[model samples]
Target: MTEFQILVVAAAFIVAGIAKGAIGIGLPPIAVGIMTLAVPLDDALAIMAIPTLTTNVWQAIYGRGLLRLFRRFWTLALTATIALVVVAATLGKLGSAQASAWLGVMLVVYSTIALLAWRPRVSRQTERWMNPLMGIASGAVAGITGIAAVPFLPYMQSLDINKDDLVQALGILFIFLIGALTFALFRQGAFDTANTIGGLAAIVPTSIGVWLGQKSRDALSPEMFRRVFLIGLLGLGLHMARGLL
Candidate 1:
């Protein structure tokens, strides 16, 4: 990678980290979306591997409810994780442009949902089936777009779970999801020297951004930040959506 590309990735991770620190989400999309402006989608996803794995692992265990969440959502996690691998095995099927378009659609869907504060309701009876279904769908989407927060998040939001528990649940699920993504990328031979270095270099800035964002939480309104983030995501999604056109 050129020096400029490295700097772009580092800046992206730092910004992503700040958003994650402030909101407990936004790292992957924010980082990948920005990095794609200067790098390829495959390279951006490759560079994100380390930071995503480390952060998700930390967040999952921090709540001290890993076991409980895992037990409850094991089916969803397992199916989604497996589906990620299975779908990514066909990595040859998608060109970079197609993946970018998919990412754009996902961002649009996710941002629209969040912006409107729309969430579905899931009863315990329906969850027995919906769980695995959502998992399969979520995994497929992540496999292609390298973004994991879309359908999975919305499905999780629909369930009767506490906020804290939900956060931990994401940690557990991403452990499987990100792990699968990384492994899949390797199997597809997507990793390279520069991408590996980029992933490693990202860790520091991401940490700093998260720290700064956490500190700013007291002074900033999460609601307002969320709105702004969604709007930006919407615009970025639209930009990427041009690939579909």
Candidate 2:
């Protein structure tokens, strides 16, 4: 890869990291969009997967009091996510552009639903079933579009799981989803020398972007953070839509 390409990938990673740090999501859509501008869609997807997995793993492991939470939900969540990966691998060759378009639509729909009545308040009697059901939905979405956060977000919000647990759960889910997708990509021979190097090179700038995001998070008020995150979703959704057009 050229020096320019390396710079682009690194920049994407930094942005992705910051997104993860601040909102606990947005890394894949944000990073993949930026990387796609620098490289092919497939390569961009591959590049983002590594860092997505890496950072989330760190968050899941190091975030305070995650182990007990993991033990509680791991079975249902992991199983469903794996099932989704199997389905995704079977269909991934349909084309990355198609996947992007579908993802864009899903994101817009989910975000709209989220914004309309963003706070999901579940009754006590129905709460027990929420996790497994959302797990299946999340896994299915992840399998299809490689973006699983939407399904789980509302469920997580409804429960109002503590912030730390929420972050850890997201981290764990991302790691499993990414890990499965990576294996599928490998089996399909998606990784080549150029893309591998490109992915690694992109990590530098991506990390920088993360740092910048973190700094901004410290300065932003709650309302400001929500607004910024929404704007980001719109921007990324449009970017993905462009691939379809």
Candidate 3:
């Protein structure tokens, strides 16, 4: 790989890690988006697997409510995992640009809802049916577009969970998503030695960025930060939506 490509990947991870540290999200989209500017989409996706998995595992397990979240959302997790694998295997047959457009739509809808504070509260009885449905939708989305943040993140936020648990729950969800994504990529033969090494090298910058972002998260109000993050997602969605135009 060229030095320039290496630098871009490193920078992407640092930026993404910082976002993850602060918001418990953004790593995959930011890293893949930036890395794809210099690397092939497949290579970029391959490189993201390990770092994404390791970090989210840490995030998921760091909090006290891991078991509770796992029990409550296991259906969503299981469905997303199975659906993603199926989608990933068929991704070659599906038009990737079309998938991305759908993701763009999802991001726009989620960001709009968040900004408006239009919470569609899910009743306990309703959650049982809805959670698995959300899992299928998000899993299919992630399998196609390599983004699991759209309906999944927004849906999780609407649940009656506390702030810290929300963050941790996102971590748990990402763990499943990234793991499934990695498996799919492997099955598709996307990884090569160079990019694999690059992925490992990316861990350092990502860690540094995550540390900085975590410090910032401690200092800032999560609610305010999340609001700003949603606005950013809105802009990202518009950019992504241009693929359809």
Candidate 4:
């Protein structure tokens, strides 16, 4: 990576870190979305994988009863992993342009839902089947677009879990999907050594940003900030999709 790309990569991760720190999620979507402006979509995703995985590992373990939650959501994890690998190996081969377009679509769709706060509740009776089924769709989207914030986030939010448990659940799900994504990208030769090193280098800035964001979380209204951030991403997504038009 050139110096410019390196700087962009660091900045992207830092911003992603802030978002995640404040809201307990959003690291991958922000990091990869920003990096795609200065690098290829594959490179952006590769550079994002390590930071995302590391942060989510912490998020996954910080809460109580991780094992219990994992057991409850294991089906979601398994199906998501399988779908990620298969879809990435298949549709992810459609090249950068198609992937970029898909990324934009996901970002726009996710942002719209978040902005509207239109969450459809999933009752306990239907969750058993819905979890695994949604996992397939979520993983397919994450695989092709390298953004795992759509169906998965929404589905999880719709469940009856409390705030803290919801955070841990998302973390566990991300670990599985992102791990699968990393392997798939490597198998496809999209995540090479340069991307790996770049991703490693991003950890510092990402850490600092998260720390700062966590500090600010006490002072700022996270909901308001999230709205602003989502709006920015909505615009970025639209810009990326313009080529497809």
The most accurate candidate by TM-score is 4
- Give the Å shift of residue 110 in candidate 3: 4.6
Expressed as tens digits, the lDDT of each residue in 205-228 for candidate 2 is 657766777777788764466556
- Per-residue lDDT of 1-245 in model 3, one digit per residue for the tens? 89899999998898788778787777887787667668766788889888888888888998899999999999999999999999889765222566556656666776787688776677778889998999999889888877787688778877888888988888898999898988888888878899899888888999998998889899987677667767876787777677788
Q: For candidate 4, write residues 28-108 as lDDT tens digits.
A: 888888898889988888888888888889889997969999998999999999988898888755237888887888888
- Which residue pairs in candidate 3 collide? none
| TM-score of every prediction relative to native | 0.96, 0.85, 0.87, 0.97
Provide the lDDT at 56 for model 1: 90
User: In terms of lDDT, which candidate is strongest?
Assistant: 1
Local lDDT at 123 for model 2: 63
Indicate the TM-score of model 3. Answer: 0.87
Report each candidate's C-alpha RMSD, comma-separated, in the order given.
1.4, 2.7, 2.5, 1.2
Q: Candidates' lDDT values, in order?
A: 0.86, 0.69, 0.81, 0.86
Question: Clash number for model 4?
Answer: 0
Residue runs of model 1 more than 4 Å from their true location after superposition: 91-95
Q: Which structure is stronger by lDDT: 1 or 2?
A: 1
Residue-by-residue lDDT tens digits, candidate 1, 1-245: 88888889988998889888888888988899889888988888999989988899999999878888887888998899898888888764322789988898889989899999998899878988888898899989898898888888888888988899988888888889888888888887779998898898889999998897888777889788778877988898989988988
Stretches of candidate 4 exceeding 4 Å from the true structure: none
